[model samples]
Target: AQRHSGAAMAEQGRQRMADDRCNAGGTAEHARPGDPLRQHREEEVGRERGLHGALRLRRRVALLGHLGLQHVLRPPAAPLLGQGPAGARAEVPPHAGRAAGNYPMATMVYFQCVFAAITLILLAGSLLGRMNIRAWMIFVPLWLTFSYTIGAFSLWGGGFLFQWGVMDYSGGYVIHLSSGIAGFTAAYWVGPRSTKDRERFPPNNVLLMLAGAGILWMGWAGFNGGDPYAANLDSSIAVLNTNICAATSLLVWTSLDVIFFKKPSVIGAVQGMITGLVCITPGAGLVQGWAAIVMGILSGSIPWFTMMVVHKRSKLLQRVDDTLGVFHTHAVAGFLGGVTTGLFAEPTLCSMFVPVTNSRGAFYGGSGGMQLLKQVVGALFIVGWNVVVTSIICLV
Candidate 1:
């Protein structure tokens, strides 16, 4: 009877151990102290709280008094007739642009200025999240006046660079490269997003991102077509080529996502589209549609790879923390586009346009070495100037 009792106790002990093991293998696996799903839920809650805080902060900021007292309590203006330019003394006729006036022409010019301002605003991606909204409001006009104006004057305004034969057919150097450098510099000044914000929630408004993508697609009509300052065959070709390239890029990026993650994500498609747009900008009018197709493929693949691979391996990327990967998108993609332009420009196509050209870049026959060197020189100058000026502007 004693032996049987001892055996029974041992059996009970074994059964308890087996039961504990089974419990450990079941939901206990998910009950770890720091499961990723639990952490993700916590992150979502934190993000909601942060957004609520930011909204309240912005509301309070809006209530702060403006400089209305100075304007409202000031001395009255002198008579308009004696104050200044012809408008000060003369009443303009309402029907000024009836075939003998500056009304409609001036309106067109104003619209162009608006386009320029909007483009720079899009470049402000690097400043988001950490930038003081008030400071950005100030920085906008300042950057436009100081940086963008000079670039426009130099490249498109028939300034010294244009006369020196720097061909930016579109805006590889002016828009993408310049903005990339400036964005990086501005980020350095503004610092990074909150650590928790950075790691926890990348973009709270992915839907807004999709809307921005649609705007971007339509906006190329103005971005590239307007460069010709006319509606013409070349403009049509440019617009078509732009879309084709973007579509191809989007498809390629999506395919990449499927290969790796078993899903095709819209965000990846948008990234691919953006890269296609940036790459085609330099050669929009000059390259053939077929060439654009090839360029788009390369742009999508190379930048995607760079962002996923080189950035991961590089100390510089880690240090800069370029919030939206603007460096890879604009700077790297734009630079490559410029180089590709040197390789694919056809003299036949170049001659059809009014823009002066020595020869189609290297691949099209004449002075390949010279064309390659010119492209490099132009891209480097823009990059260097923007980096220096942006740093100074931020400091000031």
Candidate 2:
């Protein structure tokens, strides 16, 4: 029994010693602070800091990228208190002054580019059926920069002319007038189509022309509706007024064709419809539906007469040989529209849509002071710019 008791005490002592050794090793490692859990925690902390640093760096880079892009893409800001070279104020309007970097303005700018594109396409009609594709590629961008951009910037981009209060309404002076004049000018430079083509002048495919007409008719909804920058009642009014003018012009033109030629030609009717659309563009948002009808009758008849009778008689005009009849379609129609707007502008409607307090046009109980002056200035500015720029582009 005594031996057994002694052996048991020895065994207990050995077990306690082994436990002490293990405890000592644990204590030593913790005291040195080299435990795996502690190292893992440190590593985790380091990884978190590195991730945070990376995120901050990325944010800074993004900010710099945005600033650089803004500088490149946005128009330079003009001084607010200075007078421009020609006595125009160097101030941005309220619409243009709002965050210039906003997406809405960018979208509007892109829309304007589309408008410029379509105008060029219309001009291309004169050069069609014969123009080399390579020449057209060069002409499109050149004319856009030289002719379209200046007119757009000057009239709509808050440049010198707009500050002086020239109301183009929806581009009677800026788009149609400039495109017409520049198209005719370029056609003069490019010269007329082949004499054989001139003699056999019917379109190869009237169906295509009719299709283009349909697209144009539907697209005018966007054309005029987009001018107001919103899908509001004014857009509706403009659309309604546009259709009225087109319908009235069509009927008038058809009647004239039957009376003059003893047959109503679809081609002649198409010309009248186009003139009506172009002539009413400037006045669509401001004039009543009835006024549009009156404007249309005059536009259809006068421009048709000018193209059919007056152009054939004039030696100076024959020398130019404006292939697509741009003079009558864009210039004459646009000018007539501008003049008609000055004559038929309804006071209430103009006051509502135009953000100004000028009197109605000469016929609508408004003073002629700002009206006639504004129209004349707008037209002259567009015409003068086109003459200079079209000359430069063609010559260069």
Task: Put down candidate 2 lDDT per residue, 286-322, tens digits, no spaces.
Answer: 7888899999999889988989899999986787767
What lDDT would candidate 2 get against the real structure? 0.74
Error of model 1, residue 206, in angstroms: 3.8
Local error of candidate 2 at 309, Å?
0.6
State how far residue 85 of model 1 sits from its true place (Å). 55
The candidate 1 region of ten consecutive residues with least summed lDDT is 92-101
Q: What is the C-alpha RMSD of each candidate to the true structure, in Å?
A: 27.7, 18.1
Go through the candidates in order and give each one's C-alpha lDDT: 0.71, 0.74
| Tens digit per residue, CA lDDT, model 1, 85-128 | 44343453212211222346776688558656655654677766
Q: Going through the candidates in order, what is the number of backbone clashes in each?
A: 0, 0
